[model samples]
Target: MQPHEKVKQYLDTICEQIRYKRIHNELREELENHITDQKQAYIAQGMDEETGTFKAVEQMGDPVMVGTQLDRTHKPKPEWSMIVLTLLLLLTGTFIRLYTAPRETNGLELFYRQLLFTVVGIGLMTLCYKVDFTILGEYSSILFFALAAIIVLLMLVINPVDGRFIYASYPLLLFPALFAGVVYSMSNRGYSGVILCGIYFTIPLILSLLIPNITITLFLTLSYLVILTIAIQKKRFKVNQHHALLLVYVPFIISFVVAMTNNNLIYRLKIVFTPSLAPMGVGYMGNITRGIMKGARLIGQGALPENLQGLTVEQVLPLINSDFLLTYITHRFGWIAFLIVVALLELFIIRAFVLCARQKSVLALLVSTAVTLTFAYQTLGFVVTNCGFYLFAPLSLPLISQSSHYLLVNMSLIGILLSVYRTGHMVHDKRFPEKPDRRPFLTIEDGRIIIDLHLD
Candidate 1:
């Protein structure tokens, strides 16, 4: 074929490929069927198959050019407006709690702290967005090392003699330090950074429970799991080792063996099923479960004056506002409000998963998986720790967490997600110019494909 005819044939081949591949399966099938019919028509018009195919190719134009066009149409618009709405809801709720609740506490102090946390989180997110995430992979070891250092420092606080008061809180400071360390370590080990991060949070979860502060542990775990799941589903991790059963089974075996050998371990394990077994230790969960059950009995009646008599929810569970804020919300706002909060959280999880599945971006998929897993895991943990009257504890929900640490953690995640949505390349594709110049096309390198176009 002449150069012009060659170009036409090339363009047609490209267009056909794009038509069959990128489109919905049904649509692609239909388009292929139509192309077959067109080929037959050309043959009937006294054209040979080669000439007919060439005609089909000529009519189709540049595939890259068409793909680019299709991409423009398909790109998911950033949900800036919904993001703003979520932020507003969070801020409004914070404000209500700060100034206008049935009673108010250090409104100014709470506002300033929360505002500072949000600002810092946003700044970090901005930095991450500007830098390529792939670069972070190079520094995963160093990052993990730093996190390990933090965990060691936290471990020091775990000793009461160190005057660290780790026990006073659920080794509160150690939770973040340990989680970040584990995640970093996993990331360096060529695991999915996000999933590793989620797994790492389990350290804090276990410690929090040991401190008998199931609320905070559950919340932190949830946040971490959601983030990690997003990473896994997106294939952010280097390996796809399906080792969930092994991971869980090994831990269970170790715990059971240790519990049989150690009285303390046995005692703690017993408390898992029967909180009454370890009154002081299990009381945290029991009290939360009982309080919510009591409130459930009242339903729309709201917190009774008798129930409100100088009794702080914090007295029932330390850091109740942040970790066990749901109790307060349900108590004052009623069961309907509780249901709404749960529903909204479910919606966010579902949306993240759906968007991840639909998006062509691998990174976005990873991020979505991270978020979904984190939320689902945490939520389940929270319910387990709180649900049955026999088992209960205060745990904060995502986005609605009132604790300064939990709030900071949640905001940091949101900021990262916002950054990803704003700056990510959703899918990898290349588009060539529709009109070809007289210059001869040269060899294309990896990730590069060129199509020469001709009007005739």
Candidate 2:
């Protein structure tokens, strides 16, 4: 066979063993280039064409061995660290609930219920991780419109029972679907992309206003903004400063001003700015929360207080099992335990952001960032509210909160993140081959080939 034919045969052998087809092609191209270079050098040293090709091919080592190594390097693996951290957080939450919950309050029943939710969440997460998240991009429009319709229908049909809307929690579950839409739209370039994003953004915004669930509105708005920012940075969508000012900044300012006049919003703000103004009314819960933290002091009471005897932490602190769970944890477990929880949560957030930054696919990056930002903003809202910093709407801490809806949604998102991590380096669009790595694994030095073999 000719030198080129021999080179092709060698590459074909290796490509057969590579599981990832894209990587297989990439490896073929790279190896062919390296061998050609080596063959040229051998010819320059006065070797015949056939001899040079043979030497070049021989230097590549066994094709099977090379293929196996590449397969191992390129294989998609589960993000075990993320899974372990999630399990740890779940265990911590379970322990906290079991330890601090009052025996008279059906604590055992709550634990069993939470355990059941945890099991379901884990199963859902594993399924999500194993599935190709990119497929969500394919049905983004359908998902977005369906979710919007559900929210609208719920808002119109469901009445407030027990002084709270029955379907209020449903919007929180809309995020992953909305994020998929953002990824789909942003991946489409030009003005069309922006229009698609605007349509998706308006759906939840209008629904939130109609339902008058300002908290969901805020979360959706912030998440959309993050998606938009990433889109702009990646040049998937374009907007000038003037457009941004008018379209984004001005609207945000107007909303803030309008929110100040809202009675429900104003009442929450009042509790934050001047708790003394309505100590027995709107601010009552805030005061009780503050009192619990203060009463706990540094090391905590080690048990329920005499005044609080026979009462669960949930009884004393409103929304203790959901929104105020962190506060209750701080009160019952002291500052040290609170710090540990905070550290774990922070680590989770940071790792997620890191995953987002490392993603090569625009869809994966946007999805990862959206999920991370959701967790981050929710955590900030809850922590700030717990610390008496603001009168923000209550949001459950991800993974740690006892709210079943939040638990399922948060775990599903974590699974999506893991999916993104596994496929982050993949190039989805054939038109855009991934940029060649400037820092190659194989390089020639002092007339000798050096294989770094270090996967970054």
lDDT of 1: 0.49
Model 1 TM: 0.54
Write down the worst ten-residue block by lDDT for model 1.
428-437
Please write out the lDDT profile of model 1 over residues 185-280, one tens digit for every residue: 343233223334545555555555555554455456544544344434433334343442233345546755774898765666566666655555
After superposition, candidate 1 runs with Cα above 4 Å error: 1-77, 80-85, 99-108, 125-139, 149-281, 297-320, 358-364, 378-396, 420-456
C-alpha positional error of residue 368 in candidate 1 after TM-score superposition, expressed in Å: 3.3
Q: What is the C-alpha lDDT of each candidate?
A: 0.49, 0.70
Tens-place lDDT digits, model 2, residues 105-176: 565666678788889989988888877677566567776777777766776688867655547555555564
Candidate 1: lDDT of 267? 61
- lDDT value, residue 316 of candidate 1: 52
**Per-prediction TM-score:** 0.54, 0.75
Give candidate 2's error at residue 271 in angstroms: 2.3
Give candidate 2's TM-score. 0.75
How many residue pairs of model 2 clash at the backbone?
A: 0
